[model samples]
Target: MLRLPGFRVASPTTIAEAVAALAEPGARPIAGGTDLLPNLKHRLGAPTVLVQLSRLPLRDVEVRAGALCIGAGAVLADLAEHPLVRAHAPSLARAAGLVAGPTLRNLGTLGGNLHLDTRCRYVNQTPLWREALGGCLKSHGDRCHVVPGGQTCVAALSSDCAPALVALDATLTLHGPAGARTVALADYYCADGTAHTGRAAGELATEIRVPLAPGPRRETYVKWTVRKSIDFPLISIAMRFDLADDAVAAPIVAARVVVGALASTPKLVRKLDALRGQRLDDPATADAIAAQVGAQCKPLPNLPYDADYRRAVLPVHVRRGIAALVAAGENHG
Candidate 1:
């Protein structure tokens, strides 16, 4: 049985108070606790103080101006059921609904999901198991188990919300003891999985703002995992497309393909630009673009799936996402 290390728990009612608590040494903020609690049990993470942000009124979903503002503490179940989220950012809603189970979805917050710790098969194990293997690069060792002689950590970013938000071009608002700042969602993750998040130690993600599209944009999220439930994605793809009136000349814009769970950060395969000016009806062009995307991804051997298998499925996800978007466009027309 995994045991949680002893720590002081503090619930702050205001964002300011929470920020102050997080500024202290060995202090960490907790929202939902779905991700943090398990890490604590595994001895992967420990803090002298746990600052709970549940009391901070950061759980509202509202349409502000032309953007949808989702509070950081908003639960997954709430976001999944939100009308605006369902209509404007259905990919995000779909990803949230598929996270964990009904009970966890009711408690896990968007911020928690966005800031989910990177995972590695070798790292996410019991202390005894990890100790037996001489620890991993992400934990107590200096060498990466995934890449052998590689100097960098090769842990996989398994967050479901990240790719969905990246596809929508969302912006994140972060607050800290110093002040607040906003950044594009794409900039929130780094290339190194060990230090995947670009957020400062004292900063807390306060909200996520997704700008509304002028016309309805079609989007879909497809995740390939080892299991049907409670399993993190082995390879997740989120694709968004803006359609043209003709539906034959071009898409007006091509789909933004964000591939997750295969790399340190969700990767946007810009090579799919081949589809920008082509109609989805052209099977040859679509297949060519899918082939380009498949070649761009380099999955490593870390997660539950084999690297080659994940690489092979990239085209499948791209094809499925594009097909769904095209069908949605046709329905709208």
Candidate 2:
């Protein structure tokens, strides 16, 4: 049986104490332990001490200053059902409900999911399995199995909620010994798979804030995975379109599409200005946008799924997601 390496635990009741504890050498912060514990059992990392943040007061979900503020320690299950989230950020709620499974969602925190480690088929194996393969870029070897001879790790970021949050223009609030700072969720991820996120060492994410939409809005999150439940996405897509009014034929005033489970950072599809002023009810509009996604996205063999298959079906999912969103809007209108 796989076992976690020996480690001491520190439970801090205050955010200040939690930040100070995380500043210690070989210390790691943990809340739900859903993601971190599995990696620990796989011998992926062995922190000397675990700084427990469950007791900290960072589990509130409320509206403040026209933005929905969600604490980092808020449970994923709670977020999935929270009225504020369901009403203001339904795409995020759907994505949260779709993470892992019902049991893991009950135990996982939003912070844990947001900072989930980059995953690769090669690196997520047992220590013995990895050792026999001579290791890969993320597992202490110089080479990358996915890219062969590539210097950088190409592990995929498989967070379901990340792309949805990015599409909603969310911001993250981080606290550290220095102080607190807020960063746009879109700007938070980097290209490097080994250290994909911009969160600095000795820092802790406290909350995430999503700005309230200025006008009518419709959004959806869709993903393709090996299984309907408990499997990470092979292709994840989140789309947000602000409408001119709450009418069945409202034109899109702004649009943002983010695709995840591809690389270290979610790909925000660019050149979407053409989507502006297009009505969601128009079938041609969906076809044009899906074509753009298909052209811009090129899936890698970072996960266990076939890259070519993922690439071929990427646009199909986009077109279907648009259709579903349009149908939902029509029903509500």
Candidate 3:
């Protein structure tokens, strides 16, 4: 049986107290434990202390200063069904709803999802299994099993909410010894799989702020997995379209497409500004955007799925996602 290493737990009632506790050496902040517990059991990390943040008052979801402010402690199930989240950021709500299963969604938090650890097929296994395979880059070995002599770990970022959040142009609020500072969700992640997030050591993410769209907006989050439940995305995609009006034929003022489960950092498809002024229902619009997404996203052999198969279906899924958004109606957000 897999067992968690021995550790002391500290439950902090205030954010400042929690930050201070997390600042100590060998300290880790734990929210839901949905992701962290499993890794702990597998001996992936063994922090000397676990600082609990459940007592802190950070689980509110409301509109503050024209932006949807979601406490990092907000439960996934709550956010999935929250009216404010649905109306302001539909894609985020959908992504949250689709994470793992109902039981996990009930336990996991928005912050936990955002701070999810990157996963690689070789790295996520038991320590004994990894030892037998001579340990991959993420497991403390010299070379990367996925890239063969590649110095960087290419473990895939499996967070379902990250792509959607990025597409919505969200920002994160983190508090540490230095005090509070805000970072763009788009810039939060790095390419290194071992440590994908740019979150500083001893920092505690307190909140996520999603700016309200100035005009009508339509957004969707789609992913393909081996199982309907409990499986990470194989080809995750999130698309957001800003429209001039809430009409099916409304011209798109701007658009953002983000692809996840491809690398440690989500891939933001570029050259999408050319998609401006096109109707969401226009076939040419989906075609052009889909083409760009496929061209830019190159799936690696980091996950269990075949890299070529995931690459082949990326554009197909992108096109289908756009079509589904149009079918769902206008101004989904």
* Per-residue lDDT of candidate 2, residues 32-89 (tens digit): 9988899999999889999998898999999999999999999999999999999899
Q: Candidate 3, clashing residue pairs?
A: none
- Quickly count the clashes in candidate 3: 0
For candidate 2, the lDDT comes to 0.91
Report how far off residue 26 is in candidate 3 (Å).
0.5
Residues 307-331, model 3: lDDT tens digits? 9999999999999999999998854
**lDDT value, candidate 3, whole model:** 0.93
Candidate 2: which pairs clash?
none
TM-scores, each model vs. reference: 0.95, 0.98, 0.98
The 10-residue segment with the lowest total lDDT in model 2: 324-333
Candidate 3 deviant stretches above 4 angstroms = 331-333
Question: Which of the two, 2 or 3, has more lDDT?
Answer: 3
What is the TM-score (0 to 1) of candidate 2? Answer: 0.98
Model 1 Cα lDDT, one tens digit per residue, 83-179: 9898889999999988888898888999999988889888888888988988877888777888989887878888888899998999999998789
